[model samples]
Target: MALQARALYDFQSENVGEISVREDEVLTVYSEHDIEGWLEGVNSRGERGLFPASYVQILRAAAGGGAAGEPPASRYANVPSVPPPQPQVAAAGGGGGPGVGSTFCPPPHHLQAAGGGGGGGGGGLVQLTALQHQASGSGGDDDDWDDDWDDNSTVADEPLSGSGSGGGGGMRFSPELDGPGRYRVSTGAGGGRAGAAAASSSAAASSSSSSKSTATVSRNLNRFSTFVKSGGEAFILGEAAGFVKDGDRICVVGGPHGPEWQEDPYPFSCSIDEPTKQTKFKGIKSYISYRLVPSHTQSPVNRRYKHFDWLYGRLVEKFPVISVPHIPEKQATGRFEEDFISKRKKGLILWMNHMTSHPVLARCDAFQHFLTCNDEKAWKQGKRKAERDDMVGGNFFLTLSTPPTPLDLQEVESRVDGFKGFTKRMDESVFQLSHTANEFARKQMVGFKKEYQKVGTSFRLLSQAFEMDQQVFSVGLNRAIAFTGDAYDAIGELFAEQPKQDIDPIVDLLALYQGHLTNFPDIIHVQKGALTKVKESQRHVEEGKMEPQQADGVRERCDTISFATLAEIHHFHTIRVSDFKTQMQHFLQQQIQFYQKVTQKLEEALQKYDGV
Candidate 1:
């Protein structure tokens, strides 16, 4: 855990004990005064040696001037002087011209103009006046910055720190917490997904400019998305419940959203009526048939356990990576056991959850086909239950792990980068969930409520017609359906509790990750600047242009600033990354528990009207 920076070049040692640095390698500076013209450092490989300062550019941002990657210093004409321990600049061969805003001077305007854009003989300075106009935001036209220079080229100077154009004066990006409060930034481009990338980039820039900066977020008022986020989709009763009809595109709603049921929130529950005496025959005993008493349409489908297995198989084939719910273990011997039947019902419910909650697998064509299909012949000819080859093995699924304590910098960075893809998927899932889940839940619940009301009216009419002779059966049936509908209503309430709880944490985490990712690039840039200084010092010593005393003094100061910045960067990043890991684990565990409770509530609800 030493203070470390990335090297920009390869250095060779002429004598033994000299540290040779390789390009793009991260190394730690140990002692500065161990040698003159050469500094002592430890490489990533854990070797200690002396390297000529002229060989590498430091990538960490400096305290006073431009970061290593900032626009060249020549862009600023009247650069202000910065206080002590200025950045070291590598001398270009031929002529040592004006460089480094903190210390190096620029050629006069007359010399720059006469030299025609200041190419050779140390006169390669651009018109500082033009840069001033662009920085002031006064020009109808501005020069496009080029990124063409070889990083090791002797052309001197990084962009001036504290300038209006380039973020300057040694600004650092840090996230600070005030209390137990969560923050989200509103996107300027409304709520479009396209705006997400731009808005995030803008947010990162803004956050880094100050420690108290807030993240920019795209707004999501998507009612359906929010509704499903709360577990409203758990209310879907499947094809047997008569919620879906043929020729419908599968979305979260039980059916399509028309104008009729926009604000309803009643949840769905599917139920099976008691089997008839004829179905109790020895051959049909194993069938254990259940007819879905439709919540919407009257054309309820008859299903048995085998049909569910077929649906499960197709779903696994389609989205193998998604964790499939534990289905009731197949019972070939006790098909008629009461315990077996009850377990099967719960299994079916969990199956629905697995299908609906997943962001990707939830909406697959096979799942839609399973939910809406009612053809008895096809049900009888169910699919094979064997696992698909691709289902169990693929790199597509995210592999998750908890970050270790006390920090391994390389491991931490690697894991963070990996988490980036998964976090992005979470963001997308939340975004999508917010847009459709609420609206779909409301529409379906309202439609079911309205339908239930009609069924109530029909029950009363039928009882009157029968004059109590057959009314008891109708009453029993109506009561069961009512029980199912009531459960839906209660579950809708449960569903609403989740979006705020679940999604807010995700948003917070994304903000954290985005902020961290942003800061990493800045460190590399600053380190490059440090390397540039080392090179300048080395070049001066070798050419005998700088006195021995002056060279020693520059190396000493450079070591202090460089290593100190290195330690600070590592410390800050480690704390934030560790916090990020904790947050991630908390959010994930909460989601798992939330769904488990939801599943239990559903089980209780479904068991209320067994064999009604």
Candidate 2:
């Protein structure tokens, strides 16, 4: 009987003498090739060539009586000519191949035997038999099976010594091989190496190669590998020569003298209003669009919530150290409801106010684009430009002009630590305040309004009872009682309306600051991480592992992060002070007006009873 094997993976011929084989194709094995990882074979088409031995599983070994052109008994000694194991479906987590489970359901076409249609349909679980050894003279230098197989391919019942490479002297097999043996094969999308039993008999055959393969996979999977692989240009370092332009405005490094701002030459504010329902793709999709009119341009632009969201992301990416306030949250269902729309509109208005007031944020190219670009093409161009900006992250610090004198490193660290502590406490307080104020607003809208209405109802009932009396003296008292009832009803309306003017605005302001507070800690961590690197470099210099000049370069890079962080901290404090003062003043004024209205209504009701 002729020795035959089934191709477990598709093999494209890299060399002229090698034949290409599709996955699941069967080929007749002529003899073991002179090469270490290859085999001489004839495919279904009768085209003779050499193919990788690792890509196929042995279907049948040559008969005991040696025939001409057959591989010697030493190579096929362990490979029995028993019938192929029946296909079995096992659960996915059963111990088996590297990254693949023990059982695999081959496609219907794969289950069909070579020469004729085999039994069983697609998705039938199949247990692959032992893999053949790789021959060296395969005509293709790239046909290294040791590189494809993983080290974790141990048989569940019988453990194998070597990683899944078949380069040892002879084939190895379990003592009780007649049963349903635990053999693993690659069921990956394209094709992979076989399991533990396929490894070389010699334990040390491919140990070094296996380690290299494992390390390559681990390095590729790392999250920071992209930045490392890109030569540190992904975030764009400021020191990266030729990337920074001369005219770019660099942020001034903050020190004991305090932070300085790059004043906006053309300061302006923007108004967001006129929310209207919008549709696209012939109304298949609908959303709300808000009208934005900036004071600088006076050119109104329409934007949806998603546009604002996109701009917010760009701002955060460009200014990692700066606290970019979050926009209103997205809603999936009931988004078109009147109440939700109104609430979201208020949030966007508050968000825009902050964006316009901050000198740095106001001058941001992305913000300007969002506010001023009315043309669709111009808006898209501006968006893409902002996204592709190189001056971001640590590179953003490179854009800053430090003080003429070097900052005291100790003082800078102390100041940063203090600010980090302050942000934590401030965030906690603001969160508590926001929750309390929100709860109070809810009470004013429901609880307080109900209480006032209840009082008015009782007074009106008393007035109605008094009206039933026909005495002349009671008439004046009755009219006064009715007036008092009306006054109470008016007071109830004020109670319901008060929150929107005072408490609600206060809550919105606190919420915005809450977002800023959360962002500060991350910014501080980035600076601290840079500082740690500088210390490590110094230590390396002391140990003779690094040069003094190299340590100085590390310190210089550390300064960039520190400068940006300190400047951002100073800017945050300034904005916080101004914002609180304005909001408190407005809140007090609203409170006074609300109570005054209530007092006047009560006095008018009192005058109706003057005679009585």
Candidate that would win on TM-score = 2
lDDT of each: 0.35, 0.58
User: Residue-wise lDDT of candidate 2 within 445-517, one digit each (tens)?
Assistant: 8888888888888888998998899999999998898888888888988988898899988888888888888
**Segments in model 2 whose C-alpha atoms lie over 4 Å from true places:** 1-242, 253-257
Q: In candidate 1, what residue range of length 10 has the lowest lDDT sum?
A: 234-243
Per-residue CA lDDT of model 1 for 139-173, tens digit only, reads: 11111111111123232222222201111111101
Evaluate model 2: give its TM-score. Answer: 0.61
TM-score of 1: 0.27
Clash number for model 2?
A: 15
How close is every model to the real structure, measured as TM-score? 0.27, 0.61
What local lDDT score does residue 313 receive in model 1, on the 0 to 100 scale?
Answer: 49
How many steric overlaps are in each model, in order?
47, 15
